[model samples]
Target: NKRVNHKRVYRLMKQLKLKAIIRRKTKRYKPFTPEVTAQNILNRSFNETKKNKKWLTDVTEFKLKNGNKVYLSAIYDLGSKTILSYELSSSNNNQLVFNTLDKAVKKVKNTKGIIFHSDRGFQYTSRSFKAKLKEHKMIQSMSRVGCCIDNGPMESVWGMMKSEIYKGNKNFSFINYELALIELAKYIHFYNTNRITLKMAKSIA
Candidate 1:
C-alpha cells in the first residue's frame, strides 16, 4: 500500500529497535599474480652520491574537468635530484612506463648495474618491463610488499610537485586535457632547471 512506504517503515522500525539483516555477496574473481617480481635491493637506502647510481620511478594521475584522467610516469634520479624523463598518457598501461624508461635510457650512455627502484606496480612487475630492464643491463629493485617507505623519495617528490602546481589546493581539476599536459610539461622543466633548484640553492646558501 502507498501508506506503507520505506520511510514510514524505517521510522516504525527505529521506534521498535528493529533492524534488517543483509548478507554481502562474495567476489567471484580470483587474485591476480604478476608475471615477475624482484627483491627490494634499495631497501630504504635512498641516499646516493653519484649521478645515475640510483633512480626511482612511479606513476601518478591527474583528473581533468571533463572527468577524464591522465597518467604521468616519471623517473627521478636520486643523486642529481632531477627528473631524467617522464611520459604522459591517457592510459596507465605498460606502454606509459616503457616509454618513460626508454626515453631516460636514451639520454644516458651507461646504465649498467644502476639500481632502478620502484613499487610492485603491475606495469613494473610485468614480463615485458623486466625484459626491457634486462636488455638495458639495469638492476631491478622493488619495494617489498606493504612497505611504502622503500619508495619514499619518489613519493615525496610527487607530493612536492603537486603542492607547487596546485598551490595547496586539493583535487585541482584542469579545464582541458591538452592544457593540463602543457602545464605539467612546463612544471617539470622549471623544476629541473629553475624552480626546485633555486629552492635547494637558497636552503644551502
Candidate 2:
C-alpha cells in the first residue's frame, strides 16, 4: 500500500522470519590516483603565432556497425590548425596518448616550452605523461573539472572531423575495428591536405 513505509515493511518481514533476496553486481569498485595535474595555462586562448608554441589534444571514439568501438587520440597544432599526429586503438589508455604525442614529437624539433593543452583525462595526468612533457621541455595544461569549453578548439576539431567523415559517405559503415581505424586515418589525411587547402582557397576567393 502507498501508506506502508519501508521500515514497517522491513520490520514485519523480519518478524515473519522472511527475507527478500537482493542482487548485487559482481564488479568491485577501484580507485586510482592521478600522477600529475596542472593549471589551465591555455585559459581559452586558442591562438598562437608559431606552429609549435601551442598544441591541443583529446581522445574521441568511433562506433562500428558490429557494436564495437575504436578510440582515436590526436594532437592538433593550435596555430596551424593542422592535425600533427593521431593514433587509433581499441582501448582508450595512456599508451594511445603516448603514441600520438611521440609521433607528433618525432616530426618536430626544439619543442621547448610549448604549451600542450588537454582535458584532465587520466592519460594526460599520468606520471609517465608528465615525465614525457618534462623530457620534451613542454608545458602541461588541463581544463578545469566539467568544463569542456576550456579546450574548445580541440573539442571543435573532433566534432568537425567526425561530421565530415560521416557526411561524405552516408551509406558507408565502419564494419569492424580495423576498418574504422583505416577510415579514420584516411579522413585525417584528407582533413590535413585537401579540406584545409580548400578552406584556405575559399577564404582567399
Candidate 3:
C-alpha cells in the first residue's frame, strides 16, 4: 500500500501545538460559449514583438464600503509586462471595461492590431465592450471556457495584492478604497520598474 501509516497523520490529539489550517471549497460554473472566430491571438502565451503589440486585460473585485464591491480592471502590455491602464468602478460593468480599454488605447496609440485577451466575463463579452475593441481596431481573445490558468498572471497579481494590501482590513470604507487605490498604484510602479521578474530574467516593466 502506498500509504504513510504514521500515527500523526490521523492524530487529532495535540490541540495545544496545532498548526493553523486553511480549508478551501471548489465552485463550478457553466462554460462560456466558445469564440473560435477570435484568433488564439495571444498565442496562449505572453510574448509580443513590440511594446504595444499585445495586451491582456482582467477584472478583479474587492469588498467595499457597506458590503458593496469595487471592481478593478486593467490592461497589461505583453512586451514590457507593465500595466498600460487601469480603473476602479463600483460595478464590473461593460462601461468599466470600455473605459479601461479606451484609456489604454489612448495611452498607447497605434495599436492597430493589438490583441486584448481576457476571460469570458459578462463585461468582456458584452456588446459595448466588443464594439469598443472593434472601434480601436483591436483583436479580441478569450481564455478557453473554465480554464482559469489561461489567465494565471492576472490571478497571481490579484493574490499578491490581496495578501499584501487587503488581508487585514475588516471593513471597507471610502477612505480605505482611496488608500487601497493609491497603494495599488505604487505597487504597479514598483512592479513595473523595480521588481525583478524571474520569468523575464531581469527587472523590467
> Using Cα atoms with residue i matched to residue i, what is each candidate's TM-score against the true structure?
0.82, 0.79, 0.75
The models' CA-based lDDT, in order, is 0.90, 0.88, 0.74
Of the pair 1 and 2, which is ahead by lDDT? 1
Model 1: per-residue Cα lDDT over 29-111, one tens digit each: 34568789999999888768688999999999888998999999999999888999999998989999999999999989999
Flag regions of model 1 displaced more than 4 Å: 1-31, 196-199, 202-204
**Cα lDDT of model 3 by residue, 1-205, tens digit:** 6776656654654645566567767767566553333545565676554688778889887775566767889887877767888898777677888888888877774877877888878777767677778887888888876677777767777777676566676353434677657767887777778766776674353
RMSD of each: 6.9, 10.0, 5.5
Report the poorest 10 consecutive residues by lDDT, candidate 2: 24-33
The parts of candidate 3 lying over 4 Å away from their true place are 1-12, 15-22, 25-39, 166-175, 199-205
Model 2 stretches astray by more than 4 angstroms? 1-32, 168-173, 196-203
lDDT winner between 2 and 3, please give it.
Answer: 2
The best candidate by TM-score is 1
Residue 31, candidate 1: how far off, in angstroms? 5.1
Each prediction's total of clashing residue pairs, residues at least 3 apart in sequence or on different chains, is 0, 0, 1
Error of 2 at 62 (Å): 0.7
lDDT, candidate 2, equals 0.88
- Decoy 3 TM-score against native: 0.75
